[model samples]
Target: MALGGCANAWAAASSASLPFDDIAGSFAKNEIVELVEEGVVNGTGNRKFEPKKNVTRAEFVAMADRLLKLAPVDADMPSFADVPAKSWYYGWIEAAVQLGIAEGKSKSSFEPSARITRQEAAVLIVRALKVDPGSDTGSGLDYKDKSQIAPWAAPYVQAAHTLGLMGGADGKFRPVDAMTREETAAVLDRILHDNVWSKAIRQTPNMGLQLGWQNGLTTAQFKEQVKNSAVNTLVPRWFFLEYGSTPVSNHADPSLSSWAKQNNKKVWAMLGNHSDSALTHQILSDGHARAAVIQKLAGYAKTYGLSGINVDFENVNPEDRLSLTAFISEFGTSLRAAGAVLSIDVSPDLGTDWTEAFDYEALGRYADYVVLMGYDEHWDGDPVAGSVSSLPWVQSALNRMLSVVPAKKTILALPFYTRDWTLQSGGASSEELTLIQQGYRIRSVAYNRSWDSDLGQYVVSYMRQGSQHKIWVEDGRSLGLKTMMAAKRGVAGYAYWYVGAETDEIWTSLSNAIRYASY
Candidate 1:
């Protein structure tokens, strides 16, 4: 039978054996046993893996050819003038040539009968996988006769040498020596196990060392794998507005701390609207008030191991603009110096000089992040069927701010809580009832916008009078669209003003949208 056909037939019928299976016996039985047990070599027919027979050069070619599973090209066998279509090893020779594992001794001439040397086998095995034959430093492996290897094969020989697979018998590489069947099988098996072919086998490292073991990964690869798996940024936002006179009894709660420390989450201790007039005045009058706040912030950061801080002070006087600026500049410098993140909520005023109550430009320069408070355009005081912040109005405000502030530092704030208004006979009035008291109905919330020709801006639609129906504001769907707009604008990220007041559905939807969002 042809060698290639025999190899294939043998391979098709072989059964896998455990690595530790017993094989000691007669030479023929041992050859078959070891070959079958190691799954390195195979043979033809009934449970036979021809053990003691001297492997022919063509047979070696056929065995190595099976590793690649390459298709034979449609061509005549030209390895040797003696080789013919009827030759027993024709198919194997064709496959070896196709895989570049074996080459002609001369053009159209393969020395099929020549004994394959160990050096020749090494070169062929490395070449089959396109392994780089590196420079001849003669430095790595102290193989005594390394200088005898031909310059063309230096790299391949060096790689095999470094891999500890090429120390020759009798303590010498014996570069020019021919190989025995046993030597060939050992080297070929090692090469196969190392090259990526035996991925499944090598993945089973020291069985107990399950902490880190993967296909073809060295210690460096293993360390890098762990590091890469751990790579993530923690970006928690502390609802600064929420912290107040209410004592936080849950500070020791693991769930709260866990949530804060999770990747892309953090705590922001709310420097809320100071009900204490003394503290409020302290922020305005004392030049060192900023420093005091910075000290307080540093303490907070260290205490909570916080990722950052967010300032949510509301109703500060117009006169405090410069104080606010100085405070922010110093506070930002302190936080950044301490390697903490800082974000601030700001009044959404488009006009630069129109409102000096809060300096947007100065705040932008000092804060790492600035959230545009884009709600409350119409409130309990103003009875109008209009959006809290219309698209055009938001766009206009954004354009004006972009003129002064860097785009990346901005986070478009989407209001989680919507305002409800009562439609009266003559006009509309803001509903005094809290959102939860309204029976949790969300469809009543109309996300409406219309172009106002006179104002030349899109106006939000809300109930203004009788029969127009009270307007319930934004929900997740509307907020998601706004978040997309923020992402498209390349803002740092979207921020929901107050996550507490938001329903589970709203949180789920918005969180889902921005869960993997990149800044």
Candidate 2:
């Protein structure tokens, strides 16, 4: 039988005897046992892992094939002088080549039996993950032998290290040293467990925002208020894509970015269409215009030293759905190259024309986090009276969104403000009021406020100026419940619509909810 065929046969049989004899007290014992059971690795014979034994290129290729579950490609194998066509490992090596996970040592020779070096392993892993090591300008390598690393492998080594797939020993990355079986197992384990495909996917708690531009709060004031809160990421509306395909700067405050950095918080520069549907459609439909906008936004993010960019394109036409996705994909590539996150704010999928323009799955694939605007269940202009974002309604929206978006890349955006509906003869009009303002209005009117468990908020109804007024208050209790729900669902995090609109108790509630959810 061919070597690759024999390897698989051995793997199938070796599952009966896990925990190789020689690996009992080894540091990599658990991982070796696990990989052996996972059929990604098999003992050399005599039921031993030989953890210290050097791994060959052919062996590593077979292991990678098993781990990645690579499908057989229906094509003629590339001719390698050293790798015979009839060899068992030949099929896996060819599969690796087809997957772009491995390459030949020379034009005509794969040197399949040669020991795999650390650098070669790094390059293979990086290629397997499809990581784009753009420019390699972030941080200098801490390895003592970094200079000895091959020029071609430097980026791969850096990327592998950044992804937590590989690390150095004694401050030295023995680039040319042969990788051991244990090391290979450990690296594969890290890839399976710890490696984040994208830096934008936060593994920790991420409480973010969409800073209300009209608040006019200085950086100092904003920092002082939220210094003790759970807020860790700030998205200030700093730029707007104007008509005529122009990128206009809004509140370009550098202090906000600096303060956020000083506090170990991330600042994402927000770019919006300013609710202009025509302008959004015009920019998205034209490829050149869209590219220009993306370029400008990427440049602005780099210039302002921002950690990321938040896309808040609203009221987009359904015709521009694919165009919007294309724009985000390109923009994300550029931003990711610059080590920046790309978050997109999408309205709740309520079967509306405006919300239908967003392709949740497509956007989730390209953008780091898809921020669900969980509010506006009933907007200011809507004739019906209802909660802005009721529990049932938000839960339904979340379920639909998660059907396409990964929970790890989803951010639940909640409303910190409520709408005060004024019922007049013509129609009902509402004013957006902060949580504190809603509280004051409720108190000043002497309205009887009661909690509606169905809506998960306090509802108030009163008469004023010959018109029946109503307020569905979104305070600590309501926001906390939503926050806990998001945490329970294992979303990336939650974001409040506006920063200054929230009450002090709202932060406490969020922090408590996060604590209770234990995510």
Candidate 3:
């Protein structure tokens, strides 16, 4: 976990991963170093960043594509006269144009090799951030060189400066000067760690606390089991975002916060999007709606004394990938300003509506923690019956996530339930089985069981109703072993899916594993 003390040894190590041989003593050295760690920008080769080199239209497009994870776009012919299908940056240019972020030198010419000026860069960045141009076009500028800015580009330049995406030197806007590689990196760094983002003190903290989510449980029902469980951080699925400018609470429970305050536990309220992609698009794309939700969520966090917020937006449209990134950055800034941490839930990077919108690298930078939903290796939709979250699958997914997200900022979410897979007629279907229910089922049926050492789980099989039933059991033993394995990776912490689904022994096993693992 590299986020120790927020920016500790791990951060230092990551920064050194790209030791640009030429950036020493440059004004943008720190910014260059930071972007390198995020895997957003790179050197020119031979360990040199060529910080003073000028950026071209094509070069800027490539860098912006990596930072935004823009959706791919295809074209039957060239997107422009200069941007041909054979070029390395053809798709990125097409995306830039179709996504409404870029412009061409002429009606037919993109001038891919032409140097881009600072004002042009500002226009592109403001468009890419998806914010409308400043309405009071003539009032936003204060730079000494403001007069030099093109009249047509004044609004975008004003918006870019107001958003802190671009700045001037010696109060000079330098609108006509070309942006250097180092200057470009500074802009990207500001995007990742904006003025508001500096308020986020705990990029990753207190990974030792045992965490669990709560849904559909009253205070009385939850307290009964939680009082004796190993859990210390409680995340309630309480808030929600609805269509257009109106966000709803979905009946948020305040008693849970009362309990957390009295019990020496922490509370992080969860916000869901109802898996509605169009609605989410409205929130992310509309500046007013996005700000309202951030304001409302931040107010709720403050009012409820929430230690953090757990975002569980799922089934998002992939086209909203960059928009989601922008929202998280803004929302997290607001949450941290209100003294709440931001932890976003993400599925393993795969081909599902639930997983497509997330760009892990961007999310990791925007949120304090990235909770990897380390389950659903073999979902109910799969034709084969297998472990809901096999040990190998969890291990692989966690490792892949750590490559982009810092380990200290990554949380592994464990499944508190498994599946009773039924195989018949060359098709397979499965029933979700809670930890306690699986234990009961194993006792009632004649089962053949064995430990798959490689998977770190118990494989059980039984025959009933003329079909073979296979259960990759998730019990205290298996879960404990999985915890121990994850601990070795130095992840920030672990979190289970939901509360009230497991027996008391599961907590005991997990607590011991978390405490005793030799990390």
In each prediction, how many residue pairs overlap at the backbone (N, C-alpha, C within less than 3 A)?
Answer: 17, 4, 1
Query: lDDT scores for all predictions?
Result: 0.54, 0.77, 0.79
> Over the stretch 133-233, how does candidate 3's per-residue lDDT look in tens digits?
95656366788878898887788888888887887889888999999999999997787776433333214223375778885578788777788777788
Query: Where is model 3 poorest over a 10-residue stretch in terms of lDDT?
Result: 197-206
| Clash pairs (backbone) in predicted model 2 | 2-88, 3-88, 4-88, 4-89
lDDT winner, 1 or 3: 3
Please report how far candidate 1 places residue 282 from its true position, in Å.
4.1
Tell me the tens digit of each residue's lDDT in model 2 across 105-156: 8756899999999999998988876678776832479888888898889988
**lDDT for residue 93 in candidate 1, whole number 0-100:** 74
Better of 2 and 3 by TM-score: 3
- Candidate 1, overall lDDT? 0.54
The reply for model 1, stretches above 4 Å from the true place, is 1-255, 262-264, 275-282, 350-355, 432-439, 442-468, 503-519
Cα-based RMSD of the predictions, in order? Answer: 22.8, 23.6, 23.0
Query: What C-alpha lDDT, on a 0 to 100 scale, does residue 244 get in candidate 1?
Result: 37
